[model samples]
Target chain A: MTFQVILVLFALFAITRTSRQYRKRKVSLYWFLLWTGLWALVIGIALYPTTADAIARFVGVERGADLALYLAVVLLAYLVFRLFVRQEETERSITQVVRQIAVQHPSKPDETH
Target chain B: MKTIALIPAYNEESRIAASVRDARSFVDGVVVVDDCSVDRTGEVARAAGAIVLRHVINRGQGAALQTATEYALDALNADALVHFDADGQMVAREIPMMLEPILSGEADVVLGSRFLGRATNMPFTRRMANRLARLFTLAISGIALTDTHNGFRALSRKAARELTVTLDRMAHASQILDLVKVRRLRYVERPVTITYSEETLAKSPSSFRAFGIVKDILKDKFFTRI
Candidate 1:
């Protein structure tokens, strides 16, 4: 629960810093939330012998949750990469508009204007 | 000042006429660069008494800007170029204020920021979006601005000639920023009002469209190598 709350705060900070809308923020937040949750879920199953044995028996997997956490984190990172790239592209676009405004005039801002 | 308003319009037939008519009140002349719009955008802009140049097809906003800037710079001999949206969102009076810095030789490029200065009826979602966009641009271009994606802006002839926008779509904004940053262009942001319409709000991008915008930006960035 604490991890989830921290993840939410991190998501907010990330969204506020980026040029995307809150809707985008929400999307990114969920993506991160799922990423963290899946890993946490795997960790809980692995660290706790009782939980690990029960899940392993139920899922009928020979491998334990430690391997699952590692695989999940790697896979989720790749999935999240695309989102990060898109955010960067949007940032690049915002930079372009500001540059045009900056390049054409080449004057010190007077604030009075 | 000998200012030519360069309006890059695409399939904006439904709103171009009003835009041209409203713009005539402030600008000395208007140049409408139609991006190969299949609708009556060219005809309407022309009928509204603007010097309309129609693209053979929808080439995108950057192409329109390049075409119009070339015309305004070479043929029209304009002192400054002001780019406006054909979506009927910007006010005409803002043109004079946008150019004041240029005319006074106080700045090279003046961007009209919707979030800065006085604002009216701006939606919360848009306000947040504009703020984020502004911060992103500031980080990338290393120029602090109050608003980043505000469509209304004016540039002096020198700045206009200095620009080399390569993106053929929304990514054009990003490409322009990178160029300015790399080229070290001087720029500033001015407060301007942007009115939202029910029609426009109704047409806001869907989830698919939002993701598609990302794809388009990436595709253009790769194609232009910007």
Candidate 2:
């Protein structure tokens, strides 16, 4: 999983660099990065022998840590969906506001003759 | 006779030059509000003889028009205001026709209608969407308008000055209908042919987007209504 850790680091680096440009969709992207990092952390932790042994006994599964990771993924998916709805509403309101400005403002004089 | 034509554009550099050239021949003044377009929409329109207002960030069609109308009413001291689209859908000859009702004091506002009678070069899909919107507006406003979202509408300074339009997006058409119904403005629709170009056809909002516009009106009716 060394390759995966490097990939996560690269993603974090890129997101941090371009976060400001994410203005409108920043929150959604932030959540995505957070969830991804969480999964990576969980995976790296589960690879440990002591944690895997403890999880296997706790959940009555051959790999208890895997079950725990699966549950986390499901919960994260639900949370992301809720946040997506909120983002859609925000964008919709922005669209409505912009359209109003278009009709309300008149053009200025551009010619002399 | 002192009127200004308001044209709000975003990335319309290609078509606006021709549109502004057409508008200058008819109106006393032409103002093109560039709503933070990421192009030379301002420079081209200004060079085409239009007063250009640049928004620091992209607002929307309604917001840009709102900016232009306020300037037309306040700074320009216009006697009448024409809400013209930046797209080349309207003709300069129809400006006089739209002006007649307001100029003659027959109506406070005049709407130029393409569906009311014979029109030229109208695409089927765009026509369908407009007709659907017209029907919805008719039901909501209880006004039998054939062209609910006609971009060639004109209003006297008094009427235009009084409207407090707040919708900043495409929902401004519904906002107009609601205001007309609420304020009881002396509004009339006149037949005017609108020409549709390939660019305009491409810009038509998708059916999904149209549904979003309808939902926006409903949201306002529930959340922001009196």
Candidate 3:
């Protein structure tokens, strides 16, 4: 019961945050839909913990906890990889712009050492 | 033909002036890219009679070199460009030896190979890393180079214009080999001596960081179109 209560509170918080972002035009419709779908899955699992066991059995896993841990790990790994790629792109663009500025406006030669 | 010597410096305030002075003697012009160094590297280079280009943020040596190359080509209209390290590891007297092939139109690019010449005080770890990098370059780019990460190189106008550098870090040395293969530029290995000091070794990446460089190169190969 306590687990359900905490999950419910967290789901409410996620919904509120997503709605706020949507209202501010910070998130697109596609992202909102994706995130809400993910939240819905969480709520479904929270309301019926037995569903996780069913999912585990379908996948030939013995425990739902193990399955959840595996999925979380996979998701985190993918997110981290995406973040690395994005960071690399940002750094490249920054370097390009910086190089242009450096080339175009070089400092005057100093007369004294 | 106007040959410009390019030096990328970062926090080499003590050595940059001498490097600029020495390089000016060999090339028609000297251009230094100060990569947002905290030290007075820009002022030192400028006072030494080098055209100083400043990056507002700290990129890496690769980015600075790219900037210097572009400036040399666009601003100076150079016929050839020489890539020289600013840490005083490279011998200025050998600049003409590296530039000879490029200047004479014998090769589009001339890469310096320390193994072919001489290396005084090269760390054991660095030698191993260079050998590994050479093997990796062979496997990936199919270019069997004696030295993979040597900074001393000379490129003709055509080669400099054709080669593009996108990697902004240490992995750029690997990226250049890939460009050499892709662009089909005629390149030659020139024997050049280098002196390794405690300061240069301190600036070099550690053996553990080799894995990170490999990862960056692999990522660039598989992911980036460049």
Candidate 4:
């Protein structure tokens, strides 16, 4: 019962945070949908643990908890890789913009003329 | 042809003024790209009669050089472009030697080779590192240049406008050689002297710089999309 309550609270928190980000235009609808689906699936599994065991057995996993842990680790690694690639792209764009600004306004003493 | 010297500077306020003054005597105009220097490099360069362009953020030497090249071609309308360092290591006397081929229409690009000429006070480790860099560049780009990292160079306006330097670091030197190969630009190697000062050596450490260059080249070759 405590586990189900904790999962319910987490689902609410995640939904609230994602909606805020969506309203701020920080995340797209596709990402919003994806996060919602993940949280919903987690809440469903937490409420009905036996259903997860059946699905886990179908996927050749001995335990539902192990399956959840594995999927969580894989998702976290993929998200980290995406973040790294995005950061590199942002840095490259910043360099390009900085170069253009530097060239456009030369700090010459005779620029007043 | 109206020639302009482009100096890519990063925090060499002590040496930039002298470099600008020395280069001013030979070239028609000297343009220095202050690469977000913490010191008063832009003011010193401008006071020494050099057109100064200040980067908003600290991009590396390659970005600074690219900015100066574009300004020389687009704003200054320079017929010929010369790339010189602001560390006060290169000599002004050799400018004419690098420029002669470009002026006589013999080559579109002129690269200075320290091995072909003279190097005073150049450290032994730097010499060995340069030899390794030569082999590395030849193996990657298939062009065996004696001094692959020399900053003193002369480029015609067409060549300067044609070649693109996207890397914001030391790897752009190898990228320039890649451009030379891909564009089929008429290039000649000229003998020019490089005197390494204690300050210049401190700013540019050979072993650390070699590792960074190799990493950047691999990233550009394998990781970068274009």
How well is each residue in B153-205 modelled by candidate 3, as lDDT tens digits? 99999999988888888888888888999999999999988998888788877
Candidates in order, interface RMSD in Å: 13.0, 6.1, 1.7, 1.9
lDDT of 2 by residue, B134-208 (tens): 788888778888787777889898888767566667888778778877888899998887776667767856655
lDDT of 3: 0.89
Number of the top-ranking candidate, with TM-score as the measure: 3
Query: Candidate 4 lDDT (Cα, whole model)?
Result: 0.88
DockQ-best of 1 and 3: 3
**Candidate 1 per-residue lDDT over residues A1-113, each given as its tens digit:** 57646655665555444425434564566666565565556455534647665666567665555546556689889777766667656645654554343224321112113
RMSD of 1: 15.4
Error of 1 at B125 (Å): 2.6
- Scoring each candidate complex against the real one, what DockQ results? 0.02, 0.14, 0.62, 0.55
> What would the per-residue lDDT of candidate 4 be over residues B1-226, giving only the tens digit for each residue?
9999999988889999999999988999999999889998888899989989889899898888988999999999999999998988899878888999999999999999999998887788888888899999999988878999998899999999888888788888999998998899999999889887777887875667789888888877865663
Model 4 regions more than 4 Å off: A1-12, A23-25, A43-81, A107-113
DockQ of 2: 0.14
lDDT of 1 at B120: 69
Rate residue B94 of model 1 by lDDT: 87
How many angstroms is residue A13 displaced in model 1 relative to the true structure, after the best TM-score fit?
58
Q: Give fnat for candidate 4.
A: 0.80
- TM per prediction: 0.62, 0.67, 0.93, 0.85
Query: Which ranges in model 2 have alpha carbons more than 4 Å from their true place?
Result: A1-113
